[model samples]
Target chain A: MLDLNNIGQRYGKKQVLSDLTHRFESGVSVITGPSGVGKTTLLRLCASAERPSQGEVRWCGEVLSRTPRAFRAGLGYAPQRIDFPEDITGMDFLLHMAALKKIGLREAKSQGRALLDRLGLGRDADGRIRTYSGGMRRRLGLAQAFLGAPDILILDEPTAELDPQTAGHVNDLIFEKDAIVLMTTHLAESLSGRSFATLNIPMAQAD
Target chain B: MTLFFESLATHTRIQLSRHLRSPAIWILALAAPIAARFMLPEQGGDYSIMSINSAYLALDPATIGLQLGVIMAVILTPLAYIFLRAGPTRRQPWQADDLTPARRTAQMLGHWIADTVSLWVLMLVLGLAGVVISLFRLPLSDVRPIVTLLCLCLIAAPALAVIAGLRTIFSTRRGLRGAGGDVLFFFVWLALLLLSSAFFATRSAPPILDVFGFAAPLAGTTTERIESLVIFGPASSGDVLSLDAWSGVMSGDYLFSRLFWLVSVGVLVALFAQIYAPHKFKALRPEIVTTGPPSFSKEPVPLASANGSLISLFLSEIQLVLRPRIMIPVLLIVAAAGVVLPFRGMVGPALALLLTFPFSQQAARWRGMEMSKLSALTPLGSSAVFVRLVAMVVLSTALCLPSLVNITASGATDQMLDIVAIGLGLPLLLTALGYLTRSAVTGRLIALILWYGYLNI
Candidate 1:
C-alpha cells in the first residue's frame, strides 16, 4: 500500500499541490484530471522520485523518505517527459537501466529483448535513441518501467503517444500485472469497465 | 558489495563506450601524437636531462617522461570534469536513474571510477605516443626506450589518478557546484604549478609538496638550481647537465611521493563518497524550504515583455550573460584584481586570464542555449545574434576596465593591446567553433587546452 498523508508541494511562490491525502491499495488506481493539476507530482511522490513539501509519503508502513532505496527497489516509474541520452541505443539504454535496478546482464538481455518485441520497438532496438520517434520512445520508457517485475508501478500518461492497438496492449499488461499499479491517464471513459479506483486530482485536492 | 561492483562495471562500460565513439576523442588521439612528433628535435641534436638545450631535451627519456607527467596532470583534471559535466550526470534524474534502488555511494563511486578509467585510457594513448616519439627521436642503442615508457607511466599515472579524483569530488559535491569551485580549482592548479616551478628553481622544497612527483627525482641529478627552464622554445646557452634520469626516478623519495599521492587521492575520494552521497541520503537543502507560508493560486506567471528595441535586446542579452550566478564571480574577481593589479610583473598576464574567463564561459553558454534555432524564427533574425555577440564582447571588456585602468596608470599601456586581442579573439573563435560543431563541448575543450597553454606562457 502507498499512502499520501496531507502532502503538499510548492514551486517557488506557487503551491501546485496542497493538503492532498490519499491511500492506494494493492490494485490498479487511475488518476485523471485536467493538465497541471499535480497528477504527475502525485505520481512522482508515490514513486519516491521527489519528496512531498509538507507531509509524508509512506510505502507499506515505512515512510518513503526514511528508506528511499528500499522503496525504490519495489517501485518502477515512467515519467511523462522522455529525455533519454541521444548517444545510446534503445537496447543499451534499457540494459543500463537494468543495471541500475540490479538485474543481471543475461537476464536483463532476455527480458529486455522480449519487452522491446512486445512494445513494437524490437526493430529499432539497435538504433540510437536519438532516431526514435515519440511513440517509440514512450514505448521504450514503458518497457523499462515493466523491467525487473517490480512490486509497484507508477506511470504518467503511459498511453499518451501510443497508437490505439498499442494502447490497448499496454492496458492489458497494466491490468494483468500482479502489483500495485498507479497511472495517470485521460482514457477513464474507455477504461470504465475495469476494476480500478479513479482518483481525480481536482476532487482529491478539493477534499 | 556485489551491487557495488556491478554498478561500477556498468558505469565504466557505458562511459567508455560513449567516449570511445566520439570523433573528437579520436581526432585528439591522432592529433596529440602527431603534434608532439613535430615538436621534437631532429636526430643528432644535443639534449640534456635537467635543463632544455639545443634539442629541447628530446633524447632524454626521463625528462620527457617528467614533462609528460606534469602536462597530463594539468590537462586530465579539466578533461575529466568536462566529460562528467557533458555526460549522463546532468540528465540522470530525467532518465529515471534517480529512482534506482542502488546505494547512492555505490553510484557516486562508480561514476568516479568510470571517469578515472576514461582518463587512464587517454593517458595510455598519449603514453604510447610518447613511447613512439621517444623511440623515433632517439637511436634504440642510445637509450632504453622501455624504461622511459615505464617512467612516463610511473610519474603520469598517479598524477592523472589524483586529477580524476579531484575532478569527481568537485563536480559531484553539492556545495562546490558553481563558478567559485572552478575558480578555486584554477587557483589550486596554478599554485601547484608554481610549487613545481619553485622546486625547479631551488631544489629545497619538501618532497610531499611535489604533486607531480617530478622535483625530488630530478633534484639529485643536478645540484645546481635552474634559474629558468624553457621548453619547446629557443635553446638556452647554459652548460648542459646530463645525468641518468632513470636512476633518479628510482630513488626512494620520488617513489614515496608517487605512492603518497596515489593513496591520498584514493582515500580522499572514498571519504567524499562516505560523507556526501547526494540528496537521497542527505537532508533537504535549506534553499528548498520556502520560509513564507505557501500561497495557492492558479494565476499564470508573468512573461518577459517582447516589445524591445535593438538596444533593449542588447541590454537583455547582457543581462543573460551576467546573470547573478555569473556576476557574483566576476565581481569577486574584479575585487581581487583591484588589489593585485599594481604588481608590475603580475598585472598583464593576470589581467589577460581574467579578461578571457567571461568570453569563454559566455561562448560555451550561448552554444548550450541553442538559441540559433529559435533566433531564425524571430523577426529580428541575424540581428539578435549580432546583438548577443556584441553584448558578450562589450560587457566582458567593460568588466575588465578596472584592471585595464590599472595597467594604463602603471604605464604598461603596450600590454593593453595583447589583453584586448585575447579578450576579443577567444570568444569570436569559440563562438565560431560552437556554430561549426553545433556543440557546447568542443569549443570549451579547446578553450581549456588554450587556457593551460596561456598558463605555461
Candidate 2:
C-alpha cells in the first residue's frame, strides 16, 4: 500500500494543498478533480517529484524520506507536460531513461525496443521525437515512465491533447501496466464502466 | 510613421526601465567615468589622450568630450547589451505578442537609442560629479571640458546607435537562442574593425566590413573628423599653444562634424535595420536541422558490459557533450590546432585550453544531461553523479592524446607534465565552478583567464 499522510505543499505564500491524507492499495487509483485542486501536486508527491512540506509519504510502511534515490527508482512518473530531448528517437530516449535507472545498456536497448513496440512507436523508433505527433509524444512519455519497470506508475493528465479514440487507447494502455497505477483525469465520466478507487480533491483555498 | 515612432518610443521606455532596475546596469553605466576621474594622475605628466583633461594637462573642451564619449560608448554598449536582454540566461520560445518584423526592427532601433541615451545621461552625471570632486581633490580649472565632453557624447548618439543597431540586427538574425554568439561576434568584429583601420590606412580600399566600419568610425576617420572639433587645442591649432603650455579652460564647437557623422551613421543604421528586419532575419537565422535520429549505429557505448551505476552516469554525460553539432567542429579544430601549431612553448598552454573546451562546454550544457534531475530520484547517490560528470571532462580531454603524442615527439619535455597538469586541472576547476554557479559565463570566464595566464607562461 502507498500512503500519503497529512501532506501539504506551499509554493511561497500560496498553499496548493493542505492536510491531505490518503491510503492507496495495489491496484488502479484514479485521482479526479477540477483544475488547481492539487491533483498534480498529489501525483507529484507520490512520484517523489516532491517531498511533502508537512508530512511523510510512505511506500510499504517505509517512509519515502528514508532513501530518496531508492524511493525515486521505485516510482515512475509521466508529467502533465512533456519536455524531453526532441532530437533523439523514442527508443534512444527510453534507453537513456533505462541507464538513469541503472539498467545495463544491452538490457536497456532490448527492453527499450520492446517498450517502443508495445506502445506502437516501434515503426517511428528511428525518427526524431520532434517529428512525433501530440498523441505519439504522449505515448512516448508513457513508454519512458514504464522504463526500468517501476513498482508504482504515476501519470497526470495522460489523455490531454489526444483525440477520444487515441485517449481511450492511452487509458487502456495505462490500465494494462502491471504496477500500482496512480493517475489524474479531468474527464471522470470517461471511466464510467471502469472499477477503481476514485479520490476527489477539492479546489485549494487562496492564501 | 506615427505608429513606427510610437512603437519605437514604447520599446525605448520599456528597455530603459528594465535596465534601470538592475544594479549591474547602473555599475556598468556609471562606474567607469567615476573611476576615471579618480584615477587620472594628479601631476598629469602623461600626454596620452586618456589624461588630456587631467590636472597636469589640458586640451580643448571638445577634445575632452570626444575622448570620454568614445570610451564611454565602447564600454557601455556591450554591457548594456548584456543587461538589456529579455532572457539573457535561457532560451525563450517565440511569443504570440511579439511585434512584427518591421515594427520590431524600428522598436529595436528605439531600444538601442534608449541604451545610448541612458549611457549619455549616466556618463554626464558622473562627469559632473567628477568635475566637482576634481575641484576639491586635484588642482583643476574650467568645468567646460567635462560639460563639453557630455555634449559631444550626446552628439555622438547616432554613432552609438550604429554599434547598438548592429547588435539588434545580429540578435534578430540569430534568434534568442543564438544571441550569445552574436554578442561575441560583435566584440570580435569591433576589435578587427579597429585593427583594420590601422593596417589599411588608405580609406579607398574598403574591406568587407569597412562599410559598416564607416558607420561607427571610432579609431580611424572618426578621430580625424573629431580632431577638427578641437580647433582651439594645440594639437589642432599647433604653432602658438602647445598642449603642455595651454592652461586656462578652452573649448570649441563640433556641431557641423557631429551632425555629419550622426547623419552618416544614421543612414547606415537605417539600412542595417531594413536589411535585417524580422522577415530578413528569418533568412539570417535559418532553421537548422541538426539531428535526424543519428542513423542508429550499433557502435558500443564502451559500457555495455560494465554494470556499475557510476559508469552509466559517465557514459550519459559524455553523450550529452558529444551530441551537439556546434561543439564537434570546435573540438576538432582544437585537436588540429594542438597538433599543427609549430611553436614549442605555446603548445602546452594551447593544448590546456583545447582540453578544457569540452569540459567547459559540458559544464555549461548541464541542463541537457539526464543526470541533472533524475540523479536525485535514482538509486545512484549525488556523489556518484558528481564524479561521473567530472569523469566526462577527464575522458573527453584525452582527445588531445594525438596532439600530446606530437608534443612529445617534438621533444618539449620542460613543461610536458605541467601542460598535462593544467590541461586536466583547468577543466576540473571549471566543472566545479560551473556546477556551483549554474552559469555558462562563469565557465567561459574561468577558461579565458586560465588560457590568458598560461599563454603568457
Candidate 3:
C-alpha cells in the first residue's frame, strides 16, 4: 500500500495540496480533478518526483520522503512531457534507459524487442526516434514506464496524444498488468471496468 | 514560375524574420563583428596592422582579407546554420507547413540566398573598413578592386556553402542531435584551418627574405624579376625572371587561386548536399519509445572495481562532457587554439584561465543537470553527488594541466596558480548558484554573463 499523511505542498504562500491524507491499496487508481486541483501534484508526490513541503509519504513500510531512489526503484513514472534524448534510435533508447536502470544489456534488448512487438513498433525498433509519429512516441513513453516492471506505475496524461484505438490498448494493458497503476485521464470513458478508484479535484476559484 | 517566385519571396521573408528573431544570429552577425572592429585599434593607427602589413606586402590584401574573412566565416557560418535550420519549436521542422517538394526546394534555396547575402554584406562592410584603414597607413593604391572582390568572395562563398552543407548533414542523422553537429563541425573546420595554413605558407616568400621580399608584390612593376624569382623558389640559379611573369602570377593568376578554393568549397557543398539533402528535407518524427525489456532488473551488475556513488556520478559527468556533441568540439577548438597560437610570453595564469574558459562554459550545463531532481532518484546522496561534481570540475582543470605545465616551465608559476584557483573557484561558485537558483537556463545565463564580465573587467 501507498500512504500520504498530513501532506502539504506550497508554491510560495499559496497551498497547492494542503494536509492531504490518502491511502491506496494494490489496484488501478484514477486521479481525476479539474484543472489546478493538484491531482498531478499528488501523483508526482507518490512518484517521489516532488517532495512534500510538510508531512511524509510512505510506500509499503519504508519512508519515501527521504530515500527517493529506493522508493522510486519499485515505482515507474511517466511525466506529462516526457522529454527524451532525441537523437537515439528506439532500440538504443531502451538500451540506454536499461543501462541507467542497471538492467543486463542482453536481457534488456530481448525484452525491449518483445515490448516493441507487443506495442506494434517492432519493425521501427532500429529507426531513429526522431522518425516516430506522435502516437508512436506516446506508446514509447508508456513502454519506458513498463520497463523494470515496477510494482507501481504513475502516468500523467498518458492518452492525450494517442488515437482512440491506441488509447484503449494502453488502458487494457495497464489493467492486465499486475502492478498498481495510477493514471490521470480527462475522458471518463477511458477508466471503465479497470478495478480503479477516482480522486476528483475541483478547480481553483477565481478572485 | 510566378507562383514559385512568390513562394520563394515568402520563404525569404520568413527566413529573414526568423534570423532576426534568433539571439544567436544577432550575437554572431551584428554584435561579434562590431565588437571585433571596435576592439581592434583604428586601422591606420594600430600596431598590429603595421606589423602584419610589414610581414607580407604582395599578400597584404589576401592576408588581411583572408584573416578577417576566415575568422568571420568561422564564427558566422555556424550561426547562419543555426538560424537557417533551427525551428521555432524544438519538435517542429523549419518549414512545417510547406511539405511539397517544390516548396521545400524553394525554401532551402531561399534560406541559402538570405544567409549568403547576409554574410556577403557583413564581409563587404568589414573589408572596406579594413581597406580604408590599411590604405591610410600604407600605399595600397595599386591594390586591384578585382583582387579585393575576389578575396572577399573567396572567404564569404565557401563559408556559406560549408555551413549550409553542415546543416544538411547534421539534420539527417539522429546521432548528430544537440551539439553533436558541433563536434563534426569542428573537425571539418580544423581541416579547413590546416588547408588555409598550408596555402598561406606555400604562397609566401622564404622566411629569410620574408621581411624585405614581402614588399615585392606591393612595389608593382619594377620588381617583376624579383617577384618571378620569389614565386619560383626565391630567385634560385638559372631561373629566367620578368615583370610579366611575376604580375601574371600575382594579379590575374592570384584570383584563380581564390577561385580554385571557391570551387573546392562548391564541390564540398555539392557533395554533402547530394548525400544529405534528401535526408534533411524530410519530416522528422519523434524517436523515443516506451517499450523494451526492463531498463533495469532486480539484480544489479557486479562491478569489477568497488564503485561508489561518487565514482558513478563522476563517470556520468565525464560521459556528459565527452559525448559527441557541441561541447566536444568546443573543447577541441579551445585546446587546438591554445596549442597553435603564439602566446609566447604571456603569464601562465592568464593562459591557463583562457584555456579553462571553454571547459568551464561546457560544464555549466553539467552543473545545471547536477542540481536536477533526477539526482534524487540516483543511488548517490546529494552531498556525495555534489562532491563528484566538484571532482569533475577539478578533472577538467587537470585536463588543461599540460598547457599549464608548459606555462610553468616557461617561468610563470604565479600565473599558473592564479589560473588554477580561478578555474576551480568559478565552477564551484556556479554550482552553488545553480542550486540556489534551481533554474538551469537562468543559472547558465548568469554564469556566462558573469564570466564574460570578469574576463573583460
The lDDT per prediction is 0.63, 0.56, 0.53
Worst 10 residues of 1 chain A by lDDT: A96-105
**Clashes per model (N, Cα, C within 3 A):** 0, 1, 19
**What are the TM-scores, per candidate, against the unseen true structure?**
0.57, 0.68, 0.50
Model 2 preserves the real interface contacts to a fraction of 0.20
From the highest lDDT down, the ranking of the candidates is: 1, 2, 3
Clashing pairs in 2: B65-B149
Q: What is the lDDT of residue B319 in candidate 3?
A: 46
Scored by DockQ, the top model is 2
Across B176-245, the per-residue lDDT of candidate 1 in tens digits comes to 5444445555566667767766776667676778786655565656655555555444455544456556
Task: Give DockQ: model 3.
Answer: 0.08
Candidate 2 residue-wise lDDT, B101-199, digit = tens: 437556656656766566556656655654554455433654465455454455335445554555555545434324255336455545744543442
Candidate 3 error regions (>4 Å): A1-27, A31-71, A80-92, A102-133, A149-152, A160-166, A176-180, A199-207, B16-23, B26-67, B74-98, B114-162, B165-457
Highest TM-score scorer: 2
TM-score of model 2 vs. true structure? 0.68
The lDDT, on a scale of 0 to 1, for candidate 2 is 0.56
TM-score for the first chain in candidate 1 comes to: 0.94
Report how far off residue B211 is in candidate 1 (Å). 2.2
